[model samples]
Structures are given as structure tokens and as C-alpha cells.
Target: MLISSSYATSPIQTYKQSETKPQNVVDEAPTSQGDTVILSKPALDLAAKEKGREFSNSFVMQVANQSNQKAEEMLAAFTYGLNNPLIDISSLNPATGNGATYTRTGQPVTDASEVLFASQNESLLKRNEILIAQEREKGTSAATILEKVMQSIDQQPQSYKDKIDWSRLSS
Candidate 1:
């Protein structure tokens, strides 16, 4: 009889070997259909166009949001400019940066007050355009639309009427 030696075997690895498999392990989840769908050139172009339209819509919305903020600022400036005085120092400070600063007292020259007047004129013009479009859609007469606009203008404060430029309103 001879003595036998017993040796324990090494344990098996639970994880996969990198040498046999890929280093970057991608998820192999099951899909409802296949992994990829083949589309014609026209279909691809249509999808791209739809995506562009979505982006354009979003950009228009962003512009509208900024316009609303600008409108609000114009209103505030107009209200403040009513009682306070405004000054422009562009002659003295020729190199001064563009933009108005609000303080206890207003400026002497072109200031927030000017901005208010300009912006109000532009806004009124835009409002007129929209109002005309709306009235036309409802089959309203041109004279009726003019009367409506006049009535609305009459409802505004006399102080505002005096400050805002009325020359552009005719056009």
C-alpha cells in the first residue's frame, strides 16, 4: 500500500473573462420589435423636418417670453417717468455704456423715459396689427376697427397720451 496526496482545486470565477468577451459590456435588453428599424431617405428627411419644426416652435416661445418681460419693463419705466425727471449725459459722457440705471432721481436726457416712449409706440403698433387681424377675422368693418382703436386710446391716462409719440399711430 502507498500513501496518496490530496490537493484542493481552485475555485471557478463567477464573473466573465475580459479576454474572451468585450471589455465594454453593453446591455442586451429585449426590444418589442428588433434593435433597429430601416427607413427610406424620404422618411429620414421627414423625421428631420419634424424635429426642426419642434425646435422652431420652442424658439418662437422663447422669443415671446422675452418680449413679455420687455413689455413689463416698458410699463414700469413709463409709470416712473411720469412723475420723475429724466436726463441724458451722452454729451458729457460720450464713452458711457448703453443701458439705463434707475435711482432716486431720473435722468435729464435720453433715459428710461425715452425707452418707455419708444417701446410703447412699437407695442401699440403691434397691438393695432393684431386687433385689425382679429376684427377682420370676425368680419368687422375697417371704420368699426378704427373706432374701436380710438376708444381704447381714449381710455388711457391723459399723461400717457401726452408723452407717447402719436405720429407713428397713423401708419
Candidate 2:
């Protein structure tokens, strides 16, 4: 006697919202490491595409916010040509049943993140320069000016300190 199972399940998981919450509220948010359901190749492709789109949107908005005045035009200019990344879905492996690796173009994302840090550093430096000039105008002693600058620097997040051009403030 020979027997075979012919059931195939799509990789999509559906969740019903709890009655206590409004229809607009979700019971549980889908996280990056959430449970996985075996889905069709197309469904996987769609999911990857959606994720890429979401990431691109968020990254552009964040980068735009780093502008000197957070201008909408600056945001548009900075995000020119930035688009949803191409997500590659690797073929499923038998060793990891119903598992596939996702790979996306990362260079642009990395560069954008760097831009955010650089912008923040630039802004900090500009503010410090203004404060230093104001102190000089008030006939503040060099030692006192340096002390004030150091205080301002200390107030900044630790990560940005190394990137600031400290020598500029001294001169």
C-alpha cells in the first residue's frame, strides 16, 4: 500500500483583531522575528517588496529631518533617486524547512545613515561656533570661553564627540 499527502499551505498568516479593541486596532504587531508560515513564492515576494518600501520611506524621512532647518525642499533634494531596495529571496533550503534568506541592496542605506550622523555633527559644530563668537564679543577670557565650549560639548551625545572638529573651536 502507498499513501501520499497532497496538502499545500500558503505562507500567509492571518490574525483576527480582539473584540475588545476597535476594528482599526491590531491584536499583535508583526515583528521581524515573528512566527513564520510557509507561503507561496509570490506571497514571499510581495512581503519582501512591502518591507523594502516601508524601510525606504522611513529612511528618507529621517535623512530629510537632519537638514539644517528641516525644510521639505531639502528633504526632497536629499532623497532624490532614493527608492525601495530590491529584496532578493533565496531559494528555500531543505535543511531549514520553509525558510528563505532575504538580501537587499545595503550600500545606499548605509550611506544615508552616515549622512544623518554627519549632519548632526555639522549642526553641533555650527552651534558651538556661534556660542564661541558670542562669548568673544562679550570680552570673555579665552580660558572661560574654552570652559563654556567644553560644557556645551559635554551636553551632546557621546557618540558625536569624536566627529567634531575641536581644533576649530580653539582658534
Best by TM-score: 1
Give the top-scoring candidate (lDDT).
1
Candidate 1 local lDDT, 19-138, one digit each (tens): 111123257878876768899999999989765342223322233235545423323332232222122222344355443322212223245555665666566656666776797799
Per model, how many backbone clashes are there?
7, 3
Give candidate 2 regions above 4 Å deviation. 1-109, 162-171
* Local accuracy by lDDT, each model: 0.39, 0.37
Of candidate 1, the 10-residue stretch with the lowest lDDT total is 9-18
